[model samples]
Target chain A: MSLELIRDILVATVPLLLIFPTLFAFTTWLERKALARIQNRIGPNKVGVPLTRYGGRFSLFGLGQPMADGIKMLFKENIVPRDADRLFHLLAPILALIPAMLVLCFLPIDFPWINNIQDSVKAFMLDGAVIFFFAITGLNTLAVFMAGWASRNKYSLLGGMRAIAQMVSYEIPLVLSAVIVVMMVGSLNAAEIANAQAGWNWFIFTPWGLAAFIIFFIAALAETNRSPFDLPEAESEIIAGYFTEYSGFKFALFFLGEYIAMFAISGLAVTLFLGGGAGPGVAALPWLSVIWFLVKIFALIAVMIWLRGTLPRLRVDQLMGFAWKFLLPLSILNIFIAGSALHLLAGGRLAGLDEKQPILRQLMEGANPLVVAGLWIGALLILYVAANGLNQLSRAKVRPREYKYAE
Target chain B: MSEQIAFWILSAIAVLGALVAVRKRNLIHGVFALMIFFAALSGLFLLLLAEFIAAVQILVYIGAVGILLLFAIMLTERVAGDDGRRMTSRGWFWGLVVAAAVFVVLLLPAIQQWPTPEVTQAPDPSVEELGHKLMNPYVMTLEVLALLLTAALIGAVTAAQGMRKPKEEGSPE
Candidate 1:
C-alpha cells in the first residue's frame, strides 16, 4: 500500500484502538468511586500519582487505581480448569474484546460545525451502521457462551445459558427501539441519525421518542448485562457467571469488554435519542462537541453505576419475561406509533423542518402542532393502555400469593 | 484486481464452511460452521457493493438465525452419539438424487447464465434509494414475505403449545 493510504488507515484506526481501552480503564475507576460514594465510603483512595506533590497525602483521590488494577491483573497467575476446553477458553476473551472495540469505530465523536473542515473523526462510516453495530455486538453472546461452556462447570454453563437467553430476548427490543429512531430519521447512518437532531431536536424531547429511548436504555442495560438484568454474572447466584473459570489477564479482558460494550451502547443511545455532539455553542467551537459527547456518555455510564449500586439482581425468569413479554411488545408498538406519527406530521420526513416555523405551520405542508400533539398523545395513551392491559392479563392468570413469614 | 481476489477468498470460505456444516459430527460445531457460511456470504454481498443486503445478511442470518441454530443444538439431547436415529444409507442416496436434480434444473443454469447489464460499473444505490424501491415498487412482495414469516412464526408457536398439552395430559397427576 502507498504511504499516504497507510497513514490514512492509521488515522482512522489508531484513536479507536487507544481511546476505548483507556476509556474502559478510567470507567472502572469512576464506577468504583461512584459506587463507593453511593454506599457512603471512600473508594480507591490509597493509590497516588507518581512525583506529584500531594501524591502521598490524598493519593490523588485514587486516580492511579485503574493503573494499579491493570498491573495486578497482569501479574496474577493464569489458571485453567483441568477439564476445560483450553482452546475456547483462550479464544473467548479475545472474542469478547474485539467486537466491543469494533462497535466504537462506528460512533461519530463529533460533527464538524466549521465549513470545509475534514470530518474524519469516526473510524468507519457505513450506510447501514445501525445494523452493523447490532450485528457486531451480537457476537458478544458467542463469547459468553464459549467462556461458560468451555469452563465445564455447572455454574458457568447456567450463566452462559442465562447470558444467551437474556441477550436474545433483549436484542429484539433494542433493535426495535433503534428501528423507531431509524423510522423517524429515515436513515440508518449513525451520523445522519445524530445530525437530524441538530439544534435541540433530540428524540428524547418527543413523547414517543422518549418511550423508545426508555425502552432502548432498559434493553441496553440488559444488553451489557448490568445490574437488575445481570442474572448472567450474578455473583451470589452463579459464582460470577460465565467468567467463573477465568483468571489473571483473561478475567481483566472480560471486564474490559463489558465496560467498552457499556460505553458503546450508551454512545448509541446518545446518537439515537439525545442529539449526539449537539450542544449550545457547539457550532461556534467545533471541539466542544467532543466534550458534549463525552459528557453525555459519562453521564449515562454514571447512571449505570448508580443502578449497580441501587437495584438487586433480577431473577432469570423475571428478566427473560420482562424482555420478551414487556419490552419487546412495547418496542414493536412504539415503532408503529413513531412510523405513523412521522408519516402524519412531517409527511414521512424528519429533516426539512424549518426551525423558525411554528409547530402548527401551513396546513398544506402537513407539519402542524395539532397533528404532532395528537399523535404524541395518542401514542402515549396506547402505550399506557397496552402496559396496563398486559399487567392485568398476567395478574389475572397468576395471582400473587401472600407469604407467611416466621414470627 | 484486489476485489476479485477478495471475492475468490470469500467464495472459498463460504463453500468450505458449507462443507464443514454438512459433515461435522458435533451439532454445535455444525451450527458454528453454518454461521461461518452465512458470514462469508455476507462478505460476498459486501464485495458486490450491496451494503444494505450485506448488513441485513449478517444481522438476520448470523445474528438471529445462527443464534437460534446454536440454541436448538445446545438445548437438544442429541448433541452426539445419535447415529441410529438416522433413516439409513438409502435415505442419503435419495436425498443426493433430489439435490442433484434440483442443482441440475435450477442452480446450474442460474450460475451459467447470470445476468449483468452492459455497464462498466453497477450503480451503487443508497439506503434511501433501496428503501424507496422496496416501499414503492416492491411493496406487495415485501408485505407478502413479511406475512409469510409471521404465519410461520405463529405455526411454530402453535406446534410447541400443542406438544406441551399432550405431555401435560399424559403425565400422572
Candidate 2:
C-alpha cells in the first residue's frame, strides 16, 4: 500500500519477469538436449543464425531454438474442435497460463534490495512467501483440468484426471516439507528463510533439513509433472494427454506454463535448501550473492533435466502409492523433527525446566558435526537400498509369465 | 483509488462469473466460469489484505475443487451435452422464481444496510499473526484438517479403484 512497498513489489517482479522467459527458453533447450542425449543424437543444431564476422556460430548451442519454437507456434493455425465447448476451450489456456505466471509475485529472488534514503529504506519485502508460493502453484491444477475438460476429448479428460490426482497428492508433501522449513527458520518469508541459512549451517545440512529438501524435491517433480512422474502427458499412453486437442499459440501457452512452473519450483528449492543467494562471505559483494543464487537455481534445474533423462515414468498406481505411503509419512516425521530441533535451537524450556540450565543445555546441545554427517550418510545408504529393493520388486512383479493369453 | 478500482473490477468479475457458473447450459462452461469466480474471490481476498487466505482459496478451490468438478463432469457421459436432456420439467419457471427470490433477498440486505461515505480502518491480518494462530491456537483444527485430507485421499482411491475394476474386466475387445 505504501510507496516503498509498491517499489519493492516492482523491483522483486522485474528480475523474475526478465529471468523467467530466459529460463523457460533455456529449459526447453535443456530438455531437448537431454532427451536427445538419451537417444544418442544431436538436437536443435540448426535453429539460430551463424555469426560469420567472428567465425563463430551466433547461437549459443541452439539457444535460439525456443524463440524459433515460439515463432512457429504463433504462426501455426489455431484450431477449435467442433465438438469442444467453445467458450471453455478458449478460456482454458489463458486461465492456466495466468495462474502459472502469477506465482512469481510471492517468490523472493534475493534479499530485500534496500536503499538508504533516510538510514533505512527496504526496497523489496514480502511476508508469508511460502504460503503464497504454494497457493499460486496450486492454481496450476485448475488450469490443467480446464484444458483437459474443455477439449472434449476422452484422452484429454483422462490426462486431466491423472494430473489432478498427481497434483493433489504431491501438494500435501510439498506443503508439509515447507512446514518443516517454516519450523526451522521460524518464518514463512522466502527471504527470511534464506537469511536464516546465511552461513554454512544451511537447513539442508541438518537431519530434518535434509529430509525436507528431499521431500520438497520429489513433490516439486510431481507438481511440475516432470518424469518419472509425468503421467499427465505420457505420449505413448495418452497421446499428448491433456494438450492433445490444443494447437498453435494456445498449445504454446500450456508449454510455457509447464516450463515456468519448473523454473518457479527450482527457484523455490534453491531458496529453501541451497541457502538461496547466500555464498561464502559474499555479503561484502552483494551482487555476487545474486549470481550465486542463480547458479544454485540452474544447478537444481540441471538436476531436473538429469531426472528426466535417467528415470522412467512411474506407473499411475505406483506414483499415488509413493505419495501416500512414503512421502506423506516422511514429511510428517520431518515436520516433527524440525519443530523439536527449532525449539531446542531457540533455547525454549523442555517442560518446566529452563533449557539453558547446565545439565539440560548439555543434553540439548546442537548435534555433533560427526554424528550429523554419519547419520546423513546412513540415511542416504538406507534410502539407496530401499529404492533398489523397490525397483527389483517392481521388476519381478511385472515380468511376463510363461502362461500367455494367446489363442 | 487503485484499491477501490481493483475492488470494483474484481467484484464485477466475481458477480458475472457466479452468474455464468450457475446459468451456463454447458457443464464445462459452468466449470470454467467457476474458475473465474474463484479467481475473482482470490483477488477480493487479496484486496481485503488476506493474502494467505486468497492464496488458499485459489489453491484449494481453483486448483483442487475446480479440477475435481471438471473430471466429474467429463467422466459422466450423461452430462456431456445440452440436448435439453439436462433440463428438468418446469425448470424454466422454477429457475425464474428462484432467481427472483434470490435477487430480492440479496437486494434487501444491501437496501437495509445502506453504505456510509466514511470508511473505518480495519486491522490488517498479518501472515505472521496468522501463522501463530494456526500453530499455537488452532493446532487441533489443523490436525483435524490433515485427518480430513487423509480420509479424502482414502475415499478417492477406493472410488477410483472401484471404477477401474469394472472397466478392466468389461473391456474384452
Candidate 3:
C-alpha cells in the first residue's frame, strides 16, 4: 500500500528468503562433508574456488561445491514423462516450495534492521503463529502426493502414499509435544514463547520438557522426510520416491524445499524448547540475538545431519508403530507430567518466589532441594517405566529373525 | 483498498476452486481443487481477523479432510481416472436448485439487517481469550464435542478391525 509498509515487509521477509537459501547451499555442502567424514572419505574436494585457475591450491574446504552443483543443475535438461500429468508435474515443485518458505516468516529471529520496520507485516505477530506453522507445514504432504501421482510411476505413487502416511502420523506427536511448550507458556505467539524462555529458562531443561524435546525432534525428522524416516524417498526400494521422475531445476526446487522445511521446523524447535535467541551477552547487544538464534538452528541442523549419517531408514510398519504406539502415547503422557509438574512447581500457591525471577531460580527457591530432586527422580522413573511398557506392548509378537523368514 | 483487493482476489479464487472441484472428472484433481477452495476460505478467515479459525480451517479441512478424500478415492477407483466419464448427473438440475436454495438461505442474513445482542465492551479476539472462553463458559459443549468425536473414532476403528478379525480367527487352511 504505502512505500513505508512495503519497505517494512521487505525488511522482515527478504532476509529470510536470502538467508535460508544460502544456508541451504551451505547445508548441502555441510551434509556431504559430514556424511563423508562419518563414512571415512573426503567429499567434494576437487571442486575448488571459482574464478581461479585449476590448481586446487586456493580451495575453501570444497565450499565451492554447492555453487558448482547449482550451476550444473541449472544447465541440466528438464525431463517429463510422456504419460505423466503435465499440469501437476509442473505445479508440484512450486507447491512443495510454498509452505516451506512461508513458515520461515513465523520464526522469531530478530534481525537488526527489524527495528526500522513497523507492524505492517504480521507474519511473526500473529497470535496463532505456532498453530499456523503446523497448519501450513501439513500442506507439504499434498505436494508430495501431487509429485508422486503426477509422475504416473508405481514407485512414485508408493513414495507419495508412504510420505503422506508418515507425515500424517508423525505430525500428531510433533504437535502434541509442542503443546507442552504452549501449555507452559500460556501463549501461542512465537516471540512471546521465546521471550518467556529468556536466558537459561529453555523448556528443554525440565524433565518433561526434555522428553518433549526428544519426541518433538524425532517427529520433526519424520515430518521433514529426513533419513531414518525417509521411507517416502527410499532409493533402494521405490527409486527416489515422489521425486523419482523429477530432474534438473524441478528436482533442485524439491531439494531446496525439503531443506528449508528442515530449517523452519528446527527454528520452531529452537523457539519452543531451546531458548530462542537467548544467549549470554544478548541483553547487552540486542543484535546478537539473531546470531544466537542462527547458532541454535545450526546446532539442531547439525544434530539432524548427525542422525542422518548414523541411522538406517525405518520399515513402514515400524515407523507407524513408533509414531502411534510410542511417540504419540508418550507425548500425550508427557503433557500430563508437564501440567502436574507446573502446578506443583510454579502454579502452586505455596511458592513465595519473586515474580520477576527466572523459572529455574523460582523452582529452586520455592521448594526444598531434596523435594525437587525427589520429584525429578520420580518423574524420570515414571517415564522410563512407561516407555518400557509401551515398547513391550507395541513390539510385534514375532521376532525380527522370524519376521524375515516369514516374509 | 488493500483489504478490498485481497477480498476480491480470494473470493475469485475460492469460487473458481469450488467450480473446478465440482466439475472435474478426475477424483484426485477434484480433491486438490477442493483443497484450493479450502485454502482460499482460510485466507478469507484470515482477512476477517480470525487467525485461529483460519489455521484450523486449513488444518482440518485441507490437511485432514482432503487427505481422507484422496485415500478414499485411491481405495475405491482408478487414480488416473476415465477420460470419457460424464461430469454431470441426470439429476443435476435438482442438485443445482438445492445448492442455490441453500446458498440463498445462507446469504439472507448478510442481505438483510438482523437484530443482534450488543455488549458494551467488545470481546477480545486473541487466542488467549478464545482459550479462556473454551475452558470456562463453553467447556461443556467442547467436552461433548470431544466425546462425540472420540466415539466416532473408536467406532470407525472397531468397524475396520471387525471385518478382519473374524476372517483371521475362523479361517482354517
Per-residue lDDT tens digits for candidate 2, residues A2-104, read 7865675566557667778777888788889878987898887666663445323656777778878888999999998898878778877877777667776
Candidate 1 chain A lowest-lDDT run of ten: A355-364
Cα error of candidate 2 at position A40, Å: 3.8
Across A1-407, the per-residue lDDT of candidate 1 in tens digits comes to: 35655565566767667877898888898889999999999988888976677676767788888998999999999999998878789989998998898898788775333222334334335778888899889989988988997898999989998999899889999999888778766778888888878878888977778999899999999999998789999899889999999999999999999999999999999998888999999988888988899899999998999988999988766787788788888888888876666557656353566532322222223546676677778889999999887666544255577778943
TM-score of chain B taken alone, candidate 2: 0.79
Candidate that would win on lDDT? 3
lDDT of 2 by residue, B57-80 (tens): 977787778877876776675565
Which regions in candidate 1 have their CA more than 4 angstroms from the true location? Answer: A50-58, A111-124, A343-378, A395-407, B78-119, B161-173
> What clash pairs does model 3 have?
none
How much is A130 displaced in model 2, in angstroms? 1.3
Give one digit per residue, the lDDT tens place, for model 3 in B83-106: 677657899999999999999999
lDDT, candidate 3, A78-118, per-residue tens: 99999999999999999999999999999988888887778
| Candidate 1 CAPRI-style tier | medium
Report the interface RMSD that candidate 2 achieves against the true structure, in angstroms: 2.4
> Candidate 3, TM-score vs. the true structure?
0.93
